[model samples]
Target: MGSQSIESGPIPACELMPASILISWHPPTTADVTVETVPPEVVEGENVLLLINSLPKNIVALAWYKGVHNMSHVLALYSLKYDISVTGLAHSGRETMYRNGSLLIQNFTRKDNGFYTLRTINSRGEYVSKTTTHVQVYTTLWMCEHPSISGKLTVESVPPSVAEGASVMLLVHHLPPNLLGFSWYRGVFLSEVREVSRYTMPLNLSMRAPAHSGRETLYSNGSLLLQNVTWKDIGFYTLQTLTTDLKNEVLHVQLEVETSFSTCCNSLTSAPVMIERVPRNVAVGGSILLLVHNAPDLQTFSWYKSMEKIDKFKIAEYSRAMNSMTWGPEQTRRQKVYTNGSMLLQDVTEKDAGFYTLQTLSRDLKIEVTRVQLHVYKPVRNPFIQATSNIVAVQSSVVITCFSQDTGISVHWFFNNQTLQLTKSMKLSPTKCRLTIDPVRREDAGDYQCEASNPISSKKSMPLSLIVLAF
Candidate 1:
């Protein structure tokens, strides 16, 4: 082969190294945005501003959400740059956005209650800052347009019928939050209204009515305590709340104050006052003394057996003016009336297990000196226990029953001289008259007894020995 002409296609061009290019990027700075509210609380039908402070410069976008999570549930969105737009379902005619990215809400309602979150984007289009605020809306109780949905606000006394000279508490329930102020009123009826007390929470001020005389004290939760109540306090009480939302919520309560001579008659020195008796318990054939203290001289006394308000059993009636004691047609000689206000019974039977009312009037019988309720009771007797089996094998179930001849007796169980408590493995009847144990074990072997008790007396049954066989 001829010497080939060395024609390398073109001198192999030297491949020059491409110049290395370096680029620098800066991490975005977090926008420490602070959120604040004008009143700190949002009320219905009120204007509120959610202020945004310390926002980063050159903000590209800002958005708000109803809840804490901003990724979902977007409430409002704004774009400052290209599209320059506002979009959100809550964007009613009343909502307005300020130049500084603050949100203004107007005519809010209960539906606006929740945590509101804010999200901001930096100029570089990076998700940068976030803040949250809680908003609450309250509605007035007088706006009963939706009674079933919004529970009615009410003020009620623990005991609707309270004795005079006693302390009574007025409890307010179902009250709305975000209250501007609250007031109390007392009147004979709904039409007549008189202020009793007023409290302004925001200002930390409290005012009492002219007639209050410091007897009415208000609690932080809007409850009122009336001290040393008298018959004059008996009336309908109303609770009024002046909410920031510009609505008034009112709750009403009716109080009945009774003049109890025993408890309220401190000024009656000459009246034959009645006293409370320690509950009396007498055997079937035993006698009991029902006596009154501080009875005036020579005041006639009357005794009545009150099983029910209607059809009372009149035991006896005595008149000092007549100087004679008369007995009811059904009253027997077993009862005797004394000069003082006291009744003596020779024998008490189950039929006598009821409240006895003592009625004493002034000498002219124009005014009742005192009225009291005397309770008499018969003791429970003949309590016995019956076991399904005195001896039982392991993993077997055992049942024990308690019985008493007296009705309305509660039965209590004891094991190894210790009171027995109901557990998952043990069950008791509704009346606690029966006890059942499942999966008997050797550890369960012990002496068991039962006791029957009533308000009057208690009786225990003999101890029954239980034997458990191990498998």
Candidate 2:
């Protein structure tokens, strides 16, 4: 037989290299990227920047996502080479990207509260790094002061129930005119107690403890604003005020921070047979635990979607003996019945914005029923303002209209990042969406923005700078 010539186009590159050499080769390690909030905690109607740190040099592109690390929630994409940014489906026009891969959110609102993911891409369009950070947007609650006897200092805790993660104000009522300074203590006034903060009248300056949590604010009016309170904050707080003459007045107020799971009752007679929503304020697409507080040992319990206790509206029923659940025809997968007679509703929609009834039958043959109103609100969208003109002469009238697509929303105006105060010459339309300034003044030459808000969320428009030409 003649030798056969077997031909191949070319020998594979891997065949030219030893298998041992290939095993020694490894890909370059990517740097770890992290995101930080510039000011840490941000309040509503403010601006915050998501600062990116330790970004890899190979990263040529950056993208920001809203909730999860999903492309559909992309807010904006920035290209380092082009130095340009493109908005995505989730863009609200309030997000701006910088060359350093940082993102700036203007007019931040509660709707902006959640996790934000940053993805970095290399020149080859491969993901080099991804990091996520949570942003919490807080809402400031103004305290209402009631008059106390003059010259007598008093401390009043606002809202009664100081829920965790909620803000509380310890308002000082009947503040004496001759007040010199004040100090707030975490516990009752003691030499070894932790001093939250202190203010001095002479210096007009406030000093906080080195270990202060940065959540306490001592106001000029001698009030203390506590933000994002936790269970550990529950205790007696003492406020000591000193007069210019060196006389001191001490007062104490106890703070009871409520948690998601509250005590049923101290005594059987004091047991509360009521239903409460874990989160008092719930928005659409949110979950709520319709917790039954201090209900007697229940033999059976039923939950109705409507205020009426009719059987037709029943959504779920549970039996203690059988440890089983019976779902009604109206029940959906979103409804869950707990053994403790409580119900959890998830992914709530506008249709669930009504009253809910809970009926329980105890083993003692006593029946207890309670109803709670669930206001599931749709978050208000970002509003825009349209003015008659950007420039107005003194003594000329200018009408500004705010447009919002959400119903059941209230419109508010902000000037220079503060609530707009209406003057005698300023008139608002019936819906408060239209503001007419009969005569413009130089003071109105600053930025103006309109905020549309519901109980659930709020959003402000881009600032519209008004130029008032002096006549």
User: Pick by TM-score: which candidate is best?
Assistant: 2
Stretches off by above 4 angstroms in model 1 are 1-272, 275-279, 306-313, 364-366, 369-379, 421-424
Model 2 quality (TM-score): 0.45
lDDT of 1 by residue, 259-288 (tens): 544444445564345443333445667777
Residue-level lDDT of model 2, residues 55-79, one tens digit each, is 7886666678898535567677666
Give the per-residue Cα lDDT of candidate 2 at 241.
Answer: 86
- Candidate 2 Cα errors over 4 Å, as ranges: 1-266
C-alpha lDDT of residue 142 in model 1 = 17
What is the Å distance of residue 264 in model 1 from its true position? 7.6
Q: How many clashes does each candidate structure show, in the order listed?
A: 0, 0
